[model samples]
Target: MSKNNTKSEGAEEEQPKGKTCFVIMPISDAEGYEPGHFKRVYEYIIKPACTKAGFTPVRADDIKKTNVIVIDILQRLLNSDMAICDLSSRNPNVLYELGVRQAFDMPVSFIKDEVTERIFDIQGFRDIPYNSSLRIDEVNKAVEDISENLKETFKSKGDDINSVIELLGITKAKLPDKVEISAETDLILKSINALSSRLSSLETKNVSFAAPKVVTNAANDISITFNAVDSVGQVVKVSDRVKHFKKGMGTVASIVSVGREIIVSIEFDSGDTGKYTNPVASVIKVINSDN
Candidate 1:
């Protein structure tokens, strides 16, 4: 009997942990709120709620601070199994992160203090409201509400009621593909960084360097070339005219590289914007190249 019990315990211990719930909320103090208010909310409410919902809570601050980049945060926002977005204070960064999650039609629960007004655009979406006073009983109730909401949201799996994309009848954004960096591209990036550092050092020293113009020109050329080409070897750049099969004529607004794929955002003459992934040639024809 003892041996059987030991084996059962070991098997339980080997089970995988719960899914990650990325907490999108204000990390810093906001106006009209007390210092460390959000932190307390996370600790006393959000964290416990996520645990109750069988999710491991992850906040922006929980990620390794040293050498962290925007891409890391974006990847987390894009890929987390679920997210709990706090609309307290109506923070722009929080809203932006929520938009990114919504773009992918991911599961996310919205929470906010009772005082803050609902955002005009997303006002129709239901949000779990909590008392900002942080009273003990209220806090406990809020936790229950959030936990239950999280569970429901996860179970729905991007149903129309829970997804902005579905509500608006828009296409879901695709996840970035993983691409390895080539040796040549890596070398070019390093060289550019080194050149930029040298320029900064020279500027601080008040050195009237004549070599700057030549080096700067060369760096600009390299940067332009690097920015122009997509992962699939097609040259597409901002402000270039293009024709889309369905969207008709449009001009490129921006190009973003994520992992192995490049996303090109275009604003159509019809006043609609669209994002297409690499191998853009299949859907978009370059009418003119600004590059």
Candidate 2:
């Protein structure tokens, strides 16, 4: 009996821990979420916590089922062994899904930004909170708390699984078209296309934001000095003989002096209107203009 028990313990020790932890959170560039906050939580909070607990973390955007988005989400909500729902901003879509998950009375981890007000209905359930201020120390501690809470929840099955309907002795609602793979394809494709369009729009805006700056320079002035290191690594200042690296010839505008960093504001052959800053050690060099 003792030997059989020992063998069973060994088998259990070898068993895999954690599960495919489906993440339900607001995406960046979405309506409620601003540019950087959602990404910070995903990268620093949820993902690290999941990885620490040996779980595979994935968001709705990560799911690429060529089916219906609603159906695909439903399948994930129902089929996933674990879930972490971020209830920040009380997103209608998130709340609807949370309702679906709650009815199942399965292990669902709730979390929200520290600033977000607690949902009245989900007060019965536990929440592992994260701070949006994103102070490194605070975020790290929040990640630790979330990781520990998830581990505890994973082990304590049915301990604090809260479903309002369950408490009220009502039959739990069934998931939408449970595992109806055939009906999901069209919806999924449409969702993917829409997501692609949004992503493209964001990229265009980013490029527009980073465009270069043009400046006025004295046409005949050739007294500009650029600092560089020769083959022997000596400090060498090349003047009068340096042309634009790309344009073969260029004009130097006003050399604005600000602290230790020197910004070479110039107009190149290429017409653009954004100021680009590069490391002086790497970008600044004297090229032979006599050639």
Candidate 3:
């Protein structure tokens, strides 16, 4: 078998902060030619830990039918907030897929059998240590550590991915009937509509009465930076124009600074007049004082 001579590297995109997890492991030899090990690692170790961390763990072997081979696997990897890989058996398929992710600069967490010496080093990354003994405590600790690491690494890349896709001039896929393959007008229009609905829903809902103090400002055209969330009140951001809003109330005015905390010059309208419950207003709550 032709092994990859070297690993790929790139600047990784920021990860969206969430509890979703993806596991990429070699099913054929994960347990060293043993059947039960696969189930044990995936079910008892991976699944339970992810669930306990409040993450929805996605497994490769659980995929359903698709027109392309492993289409589901690829989809989950791209969609997940974080991913874990088992390099213990040195599975070529797993390594190749890992290479692909590295090509995209995706933040991936790795684990390997303690017995397996480092065949090759991955540039600018670390590996989580594990053993093949199938000890419950060992597996549990590895899983917990990996999950926490993921929470830190890929916590906000969701927006970064969308921005990169847009810069590359590729549109994100949407609902089949709602999406227009060739019509730029229809595609943007639908995206805008979707975004608008999402934003509107967020406005109607109230934050916790004792919600953490967000950005507060004086009535002036001052610089503003804030963390925005999706309709579900999650840290995830939406780019569908309507959801992002533009040209009207609760819309994108112009991005000032677009990293970590989005800095924008928000224009308050007449409706916002005397609505100075808090001045220097923006539609979204401020998550920090850095603005």
Score every model by TM-score. 0.57, 0.56, 0.45
Winning model by lDDT? 1
By lDDT, is 2 or 3 better? 2
lDDT of 3 by residue, 1-291 (tens): 112324235655443435577787777645445766666667766676566655788877775542233656776776676677777677788877775565455556666678766645452245667657768788778778766655554543442331223335555444244533468866765676677667766678653322212333365333432222332232211221212222343333443333334444334443331112222223444332322
- Whose TM-score is greatest here? 1
Query: Which run of 10 residues does model 2 get worst, by summed lDDT?
Result: 229-238
What would the TM-score be for candidate 2 when compared with the true structure? 0.56
Q: What lDDT does the true structure give each of the candidates?
A: 0.75, 0.62, 0.53
Query: Which tens-of-lDDT digit does each residue in 74-162 have in candidate 1?
Result: 87887788899999999999999998888887878899998899898888778999999999999999999999888877765633356
Off by over 4 Å in 3: 1-19, 30-33, 156-291
Candidate ranking under TM-score, highest first, comes to 1, 2, 3
At residue 163, candidate 1 shows an lDDT of 67
After superposition on all C-alphas, the RMSD of every candidate to the true structure, in Å, is 21.1, 11.7, 22.1
- lDDT, candidate 2, at 13: 33
